[model samples]
Target: MNNHFITLGNLGLCVAASLNAQRLFKDHRAPAAGIFLVVCSAALSVLPATISLDWSSQPAALCADLQWAAEVLSPAMVSFGFLWLSDDHFTAYTLLTGSALLSMLTGWLSRDGLSVMSRCMAMSSLSCSLTVCLFAGNPLGILGSVLLSAPALVGLSGTSPLVSPEAAGGLLKLGLIGAMTVGCWAIRWALEIYVQDLKGWDKSNNILT
Candidate 1:
C-alpha cells in the first residue's frame, strides 16, 4: 500500500512539472531561465519513481540507505546542479532546499501575463542567492550571499501589486540596514577566525569562527 502511494506521489510531481512547463510554453515571452527551471523540476520529479520498484531481496540496511539517498539526496543533487549552472559554478549544502524555496516563490508569483517573466527573474535570483548562502566558503562569499538574498526576499514581497510606495520604501530601507549588519558581522567573523588561527587553534574546531 505504501509503495502504491509513493508511486502515485511521484506521478503527481511529474504532472505538476508538466503543467508548469505547459503554462510557460503557452506564454510566448517566457524567459529561458523559467523553462530551464521547469526542465530541472521535471527531472527531479522523476527521481522518486524508483521507489515503486522492488529490489531483489536487498538487505534491510542497504534498502534503507538507498531509500534515504534516493528520496533525500537525489533531489538535493539535482537542485545543486541547477544552482551551479545558474551561477556558473558554485557550492551548496543542499540545492534541494533552494529548489523547494524556488518552487514556493514560483507559486507565489503565479499571476497572469507580463508578470510571468518577472516571476521567472525573481525565481532565478532566489535560487542563485540560496545556492550562495548554502555553499559560502569565505567571508566575502557569505556576505555576498546574505546581501543578495535580502534583496531577493524583498523582491519576492514586492510582487504583490497592492504594496504601497511608502511600504516599499520602508522595506528597502530595512533591507539595506540588514545587509549592512550582515557585512559588518562577516568582517568581524573573519577577523575572529584570523585571530584564532594566529593563536594556533585547531583548524577543524576553529572553523566556526
Candidate 2:
C-alpha cells in the first residue's frame, strides 16, 4: 500500500510538471521555466532512490519513518545503477550505459556551458527523465518514467538554443511516440494482472465447491 501511494505521488508530480511546461510553452512563452519545473519534479520523483537513514542514530523513530517514506516515494536509482554495473546481463549494461550517457549530456549543459535557463533546464529535464526511466521497476513505473520525460524532451528540443530546430523537432516527435508506446504497454500489463486475478478467483471457487 505504501509503495503504491509513493508511486502515485511521484506520478502526480510528473503530471503536474508536464502540464505546467505545456502551459509555459504555449501560453506564457517561458518554456525554460516550465522545463525547470519538470526537472525539479523529476528530481522529487527520484528522491526516494537517494534517501539515507543516517538519522536513525538519533534514537527517534521519526527518522526511521522518514527513511521508510523516502524508500516508498522514490525509485532505487543507486541500487539499480549498482545492479547494472554488477550484473553480467546485457539488459542491465544497456540501461547503465544509457544512464551514463544522459548524465554526460546533462553535465555538458551545466550553467557554465549553456549559461541560459532554457538550455540548462532542457538538459536537466532530459537527464532526469532518462534516469527515472532507468530506475523504474514495473510497468506502471515505466509508464510514469517515460511519460514524464517525453514532454520534457519535446519542450527541451523546441526551446533550447543548443539544439537545431529541425533536429530537435524530430527528436521531440520521437519522444512523443515512445511515450505513447510505453503507455500502451502499461495498460496491457494492467489488463493481464486483472485477468490473472479473475482466474485465481475462479480456481478458488471450484475448489470450494
Candidate 3:
C-alpha cells in the first residue's frame, strides 16, 4: 500500500511536469529557467522509486546516497521554481533562494527530516499561490493556493504519538504530490486568463486607435 501511494505520487509529479512544460511552450513569455527547474525537480523526485525498482544490481550504499540527495534537493527546487514562475522579480527570487538554502542547511544540521524543510516547502508553496492570486486576481487561484499549502501545514501540525513516523511521512509525501499537481494546473489556469485579458486589452486599444 505504501509503495502504491508512492507510485501514485510519482505519477502526479510527472503530470505536474508535463503541465508545466505545456505552459512553458504555449507562452513564449514564460521564463525557461523556472520551467526547467520545475521539470528537473519532478524528475529528481522520482529518482528514488526508479533506483529502487531498477538498480538492484548496483551497490546499495550508492543507490541510497543518490536517493537521499534527490529527496533533499527536490522540495527546494520545486518551491523556488514555482516562486520564480509566479513572480520574476529579483528581490523575491533572492529571498526565496536564501530561505531555501537556509532550510536545507537547517535540515542537514538537525538531521530531522520534517523540521526546517517541511516548513520551508509549506511557506514557499503558499507564497507561490499568493503570487498567482495577486497577479490574476482569481478566486479559484486563491482556493487552489490554500489547497496546495494544506498538506505541508497539516504535516507540520498533525504529528501525533499515535501515528508512526513512517506512516506520517508516507501520507505527507502523497499530499505533497497532489498539491503540486493541483498547483501547476491552477497556475496554468491563472496565466491563461491573464493572457486572454491582455489580448482583449490590446484589441480594444487597437480599435480605439
* Candidate 3, 1-87: lDDT as tens digits: 876776767667666757665665655333223334445555655676666565455554443333333233333333443444445
Pairs with backbone N, CA or C atoms under 3 Å apart (clashes), candidate 1: none
Q: Which stretches of candidate 3 lie above 4 Å from their native place?
A: 25-91, 94-121, 124-128, 131-135, 150-164, 169-172, 199-209
Question: Candidate 3, residue 178: CA error in Å?
Answer: 2.2
- Going through the candidates in order, what is the number of backbone clashes in each? 0, 1, 0
For candidate 2, write residues 95-206 as lDDT tens digits: 3354345435644665334224333333443344344335433345345434534443334323334556565435444444345334323423432343355467789999
Predicted structure 2, TM vs. truth = 0.26
Q: For each candidate, what TM-score against the reference?
A: 0.27, 0.26, 0.57
Question: Taking the tens digit of each residue's C-alpha lDDT, what string does model 1 give over 37-144?
Answer: 333433443344554544444543343333222222222333343344334444433444554554445445454421344434434544554554355333543453
In model 1, where do residues sit more than 4 Å from their true spots?
1-116, 132-143, 156-159, 177-209
2 against 3, candidate with superior TM-score:
3
Full-model lDDT, candidate 2: 0.39
Candidate 1, residue 105: the lDDT equals 58
